[model samples]
Target: MDTEKVTDRKVELEKEDGHALHKRLSQVDPEMAAKLHPHDKRKVARSLQVFEETGISHSEFLHRQHSEEGGGPLGGPLKFPNLCILWLHADQTGPGPSVPPVYGLEVSDVSKWEESVLEPALEIVQSFIQGHKPVAAPVKMPCNEMENKRSYHMCDLCDRIIIGDREWAAHIKSKSHLHQLKKRRRLDSDAVTAIENQSISPDCDKELKEKGSPEQNEKELKSSV
Candidate 1:
């Protein structure tokens, strides 16, 4: 629980509470998509711990937009190149990168949409998984017959949230947000190994370095070899 080893330059947390709270808020924590405005120092420290482990601003990363399509703010796709690539596990699936595909489902008026629709869907899925009973095909979308199937815009990066136009444009310009984009661009940079920041903490940095954008590495390998 000792944070004396962490650097202060990486973050400068606001300390306005008592000594206990000051000690707690000393570290940079996850904003959970920047949703909860916490006052407790310990909570801030724990949040920072989660952020460091994931390299994600936990609280800040939550509920990106009022739009429910992807619950939090969206940061489109990978914008960088890959440097070090260990393609030893080339599967028959075309020797390609193992980036998982995302499906951004935009349901119109999702917030007001009845849980009746979702609950039954999950029940059927669970029933199938548990081998409970022989059920027919499955439930249908109650609003399927509605005329205007609302169309939605999806954010590319993180692929989690669907966002409104105004928020989308602003997100593209945020410092932390844009820097993430730059990192994607260098995923395949042939100039250096990704280990330059190897000493960076093991939490969030690990995943960021390992899977920042392995796709870039695959493209580079295919072209060079």
Candidate 2:
């Protein structure tokens, strides 16, 4: 691919709104977008948003996510070493005998990666190590689920805890869920979608149908007249 063209695309993506960015990514790199889990979509979007606003390179973004300085909602640094190892494995024929286990991965090796895989990748994700330092940490999802409460289903996209099976069922067809699903390039005629739809309560579907019915609209119109 044209390196400059790729770089420009990355730059454009960085500047785009999160939802729009996701849509563009889905169109251009659907495989990569599809690999993103639902729970991670917002986090990735948040990271992309942070990168766009701060002009940080993706590596720097990952570094911040891996470090304690990025704050609590980001989980921990260990979450990234595995990703690094995955990168390494993808680069080599295999791990090569010298490649260490995931837990043994080190930041010192990041320099090596930077020279090889990272530098090339940077063309697609320009970094801002020297300028426009971030003013604040990126926001993360609040996964607050208290013990012993009404049953809830945490949205894999936004992480909002929705209570009740019926409510959760209705939520799957909601705009928020659809937005997130599209963001992850997951809005497909797949078994997963089937399962989510199948989980909806019959009553909720009826209510939704009634709410959208022309008869209800006509009734309201007649009453108002």
Candidate 3:
């Protein structure tokens, strides 16, 4: 299918009437429409255009893609299964962005750059070139009642939802999660220090001085009498 032509047609339909296009998409591909917002004109029109051009719902195409070999619930199979990503950063100890299967390079110290970063990176590349699997195998869950009733866990520190107890345990021990936890502890400590060091406002101090105390007033009255 010529995706570019479909895209152009979708754009034309959206320009004409986005609401009407979304309504048409709902009629032809209710599943896709339910997943997308009514105000998402681009996706709505594209789904409609896809149905008009090929008589097949856009959702069906996605289902087929996901059902292919090496594909699961996530989406289509990886274009490059052996893809290697390397991240070079100055502060390895500090909180860094989260991404899976990444090799981090410490670029802060020039002296150790070769020994720490270059050698390790070279070894990884060489292993990959020699047909050694760079990525780890996926964990296989046992087919049982426990697998069926797997509960989801949400990490408040990292703001991520992890499925299955094993995944949740691994996520908590991950570098990203540890970094975020460290950062959170540091922030809490700073907040406690700030609160402890905080002083009374000038206006509040002045009001307290003006009010004095009941005991002080009674003493003044007794002195006057």
TM match of model 2 to true structure: 0.20
Candidate 1 is scored at a TM of 0.18
| Model 2 stretches astray by more than 4 angstroms | 1-9, 37-225
Please, what are the lDDT tens digits per residue for candidate 1 over residues 1-225? Answer: 777776652244434343343344334542231322244344455556556667665544443432444232233233442212212112222222223221122245568434533554455446555756424232221222222211234447544332334345566677766777787778756334555445465865777876757888798789999
Q: Is candidate 2 or candidate 3 better by TM-score?
A: 3
**Winner of 1 and 2 under TM-score:** 2
In model 1, the worst 10-residue window by lDDT is: 83-92
lDDT of candidates 1 onward, in order:
0.43, 0.49, 0.69
Backbone clash total, candidate 2: 1
lDDT of 3 by residue, 164-209 (tens): 5656778899999999999999999999887765556676678888
Model 3 has a clash total of: 0
